[model samples]
Target: MTTNILINRRSIQILRILVSGIFLVAGLNHLLNVEKTAQRIEQANFKGIAYFFGEPQWLIILSGIVMLSAGFLFLIGYKTKWAAIILMAVLIPITLTVQVGQITSLGPLFKNIAILGGLLFFILNDTEKKLI
Candidate 1:
């Protein structure tokens, strides 16, 4: 029983770290591609959502802020369930708007789907535990 408990704790720790790391890396990418990301957002043709978000500069910064917050929450396991859900909410719209119909190759498409799947798993697990 003790051994099982230890393993479960380790597993949770690993999952927490992995999920947090992914968010951190994604946040960094947004920072790195600020201009390009902003451009993409502008091109999303959300019928004014982009304008409301305020040009590429402000929008990119906002995205970075959101990602960083979510990443930090995940890292510290603070409100992790809500953090995961928020991250998924943000990622899904971004993915659908930006990557939809542009997947000429299977690799990128599968990668995005896999990330979504992982986020869903996190959300479901968190929900089941009432962690949020």
Candidate 2:
């Protein structure tokens, strides 16, 4: 008789770290392509804080840095709650202002929602560190 094992705690933590790596890569891409990211911001019409930042490009770059640092912190299990919160600060606005357009835009919207769920998981649980 054999029994199938579902996810153990180690597996969950590994999954969490792997997921965070995706944000790390995405954030790096944003920082690397500041011009393109700025163009996207302009196309999205997300200019509520343009006046405060003097340029939407700066805001975009700032968000990219936040995401990059947050992903690293989360992966390393250092101040993870704070990292998740900071990442959410960037994500929520972009999701609402940028992705919340038509109903057909469910793909990216749901993807972000799932990522938010993962961050919340990290926020609620203090998993043991493996590679930290």
Candidate 3:
């Protein structure tokens, strides 16, 4: 029984780390390409959301910072449950408002949906046990 519990704990830790790593890498990419990302945000044209963050360079920078911070927290498994939830909250708007009709490739569209599903899984599986 003790060995089984130990194995389960280790499995959960690994899963958490893997999930966090994905966000961390994606966040870093966003931070690295702020200008391009901002342009994408502008293209999104999400009414007030774009206007608020598009014109001001500082707001763009701030958004990158927030994404990086939240992603890092998630990757390190520090408040991972909340971090995943925050990520989902931040991503859903962009997905709906920006990528909804613009996706020209089926691969990318499926990828986006897969990412959302993964986020939902993380949110729903916020428990003491490992899924894998």
Candidate 4:
């Protein structure tokens, strides 16, 4: 007997779109609501987090733009590895600086890290594997 449980290239492409679309939407949402973004960061309960980021509200909007743009690249299959790297670049620092102090209690931190992990898998694999 034989089994075929794996997906093919087109399926992978759609999956990639779906994955990257998540970041794109999130970033766009953040940008559209800078005040809410700033408030959430402020709610981090880490005063130094804002001070460390410098110009917190502005930085929030900037990063939102970054994530949106990077997601677009990844979605369109342009410079894919680089796009993943860019997303990670934005993700890791924000993860560490903004959430590290309260990581143990923050669900969002884990979700962000998991997304980063997915992006890493998307970048490092043999270009034909599927990751959850």
TM-score of each: 0.70, 0.77, 0.67, 0.75
Candidate-wise lDDT, in order? 0.68, 0.73, 0.63, 0.77
Off by over 4 Å in 2: 1-7, 45-54, 102-104, 128-132
lDDT winner: 4
- Give candidate 3 regions above 4 Å deviation: 1-11, 45-49, 52-59, 129-132
Ranking by TM-score: 2, 4, 1, 3
**Tens-place lDDT digits, model 2, residues 1-132:** 665344476666686688688679878987899888766656554445444446766776787788889889888877877887887777887776556663666798888899888877767655544423
Select the stronger candidate by lDDT from 2 and 4.
Answer: 4
Distance from true position, residue 18, model 1, in Å? 1.7
Q: Which ten residues in a row are the worst by lDDT in model 4?
A: 123-132
For model 1, which pairs clash? none
lDDT of 4: 0.77
The clash count of every prediction, one per candidate, is: 0, 0, 0, 0
Please, what's the RMSD in Å of model 1?
5.5
Model 4 lDDT tens row, 4-113? 45547786688668779777987898789988877767766564656676887778788889889999988987777788888888787677765777856688788788
Off by over 4 Å in 4: 1-7, 97-106, 126-132
- Model 1 misses residue 128 by how many Å? 10
Candidate 3 lDDT by residue in tens digits, 75-122 = 676776787788777666556555766656456556657766766766
Worst 10 residues of 3 by lDDT: 1-10
lDDT of 3: 0.63
